[model samples]
Target: MFKWKRKKKWYRDFVNPVHEFRYAMEFVEETLEEEKTKEDQILILDFILSVIREDLKYDTLTNIFYREKWFDEGLRISLPFPYHYYDEKGNMLSIYEDKAEVKKVDLAKECVLVFPWHRGRMRDNIKNIGRNEFQYDKFNHKAYYFSPVNICFVYNGMHSITAGIGFKKGYIEAAEYDVTKLFEHVYTDGLYWYNRHNNQKLEDDLLDFRIGVIYEISKIKHHIEKDAT
Candidate 1:
């Protein structure tokens, strides 16, 4: 006679938020793999897009950032079509069914435009926050400096950074840290926040591309079926 043992939840909840996303994506991927025809793929994509649209109704900027849990690449599924994102230097970063690499982007080089989803409110705030007292000194702000990535993670004064960039103020004040002890966690968390914003934009673009793909595939599928008939 043996007693049943319950499985431990990693997040200490019924579902691990991180793996839940990975599992959902894995299911989508497996389903797509089993489809034998373009019509089948189109139908699957359309249904998935519909559900995603409904889910997005409640999704916000904060929620979107959490989607990049642990910065795992397995969370991304291939797009039906190629999608392009441009860097500050106008270099094209293309993503498609095969490419899933996340590039290390330079923030000062217009990476802000790469993810324009969070610009709505920040744009308005940028205007009202005057530049009269703006200073280039690092003593003015509370921000974490990631020496490995050479990027600053702002704990407060995000709008100040936005304003600095918006007006070309050149730089913001940040205290330099040894960060040797906490480098691993800081780097991972910083990268997670950085990639999540980019991934959110990528995710949105993929959904739109999926719709277009469904439309094109639907017509082609119809033509094929009609010709066979």
Candidate 2:
């Protein structure tokens, strides 16, 4: 009887996994269908805008990066740094130097200091951001910094870059706040036009740490202005 009961429980556990797998598959399929519809609408809008005669104006605000060509190469450009560096004595280092070094040494009963090697790259760990598709040209010295708040929109045939700001958390809030504002400024003065375009809603789209740092800087700037007043 014990063996029979054990077999029954094992069969029940095996079936449960299959059931869960089916449910997840169905959810993913539904999401894919929704995304396809949204993409279709955006393509349609692009076609319409291409032939339109009226001047197409979009909101320039809320874009974290400036829309400019940094080099002759086909690349979107933005300034990512307002960085700060300090030494062991808390002295700020100048950017003019080729290399900065820190040093320390130990003798029999005393301590000595010597310069340790240090080199800084213009772009460090830029892959942490969402720019996985673009290749960085280090020799050009154009891709200097990476900004969490700045996103560059580049078209296939376009040489100029359109700068925009986006949260790491997909497009839910961006659709509501940033995209909506852009559409209103461009398409019509009326509201809710961009909100209607959104179909798939992300469940857990939240601000990333890098974006949080940008917000903190804004807050600091606000306080400084307030204090000045």
Candidate 3:
């Protein structure tokens, strides 16, 4: 059995498309104030605006990371996080991470179910593996990995990562955010989009924390008014 305790709906302030847009602007503004060169700042701001424009115009807010060249080749890297799988009966079946993969099945003991529906989803993802259907376009599906304090976390694409493991494809292509302290903590199943699917509601802890961190790290001195042009 799975346990899901509902929390107060405090995510309304941070998780909507509008708020996401604001955060992106604030993050870009603060990033501009940093010690980056003039050219780098311009490049970063341009990319940020492009992402925001896409989101506002097309309703396609894909999480993307910055790169020197947006059309460059995709990265090929191993699954960077530990992935745990449990049976329907809540028994730990396997764990995959890094170069060394571990597969274990223990039916005699049961573990607490954090996500009741995740196992079913993983099964579906496994079907998509090795089908040559995956594409990581640099412009569209560029970046999903987050590294805060040097620890890598996947802000998106868990199913694909799990499926890649099942297919034994090491060193998959990926793009990472090479920032430190962008987020202090990466909670379990805390992303707004992920929670939106399961709870039929939005929770903005992940986004909230990120925006807060951006302010803290950057110490932005002046307010950035919304661009009217």
Highest lDDT scorer: 1
What TM-score goes with each of the models?
0.27, 0.17, 0.23
Clashes of each: 2, 0, 7
Clash total of candidate 1: 2
Residue pairs clashing, model 2: none
lDDT of each: 0.37, 0.25, 0.34
Ranking by TM-score: 1, 3, 2
Q: Where does model 3 exceed 4 Å of error?
A: 1-120, 130-143, 146-150, 170-175, 181-229
Worst 10 residues of 3 by lDDT: 107-116
Model 2, span 1-229: residue lDDT tens? 9999999999777764335334433443454356455444334433332322111112222121334323334333221221222333544432213232221111111111111111111122223223533322223211111112122222221111111112121110110011211211111111111111333222222112222223223333333345556
Better of 1 and 2 by lDDT: 1
lDDT of 3 by residue, 21-60 (tens): 4566567657767935655665665454344333321221
lDDT of 1 by residue, 48-128 (tens): 545543333223213324544323222232222223444445444442323232233222432121111234444554665
Error of 2 at 85 (Å): 2.7
Q: Candidate 2 vs candidate 3: which has greater TM-score?
A: 3
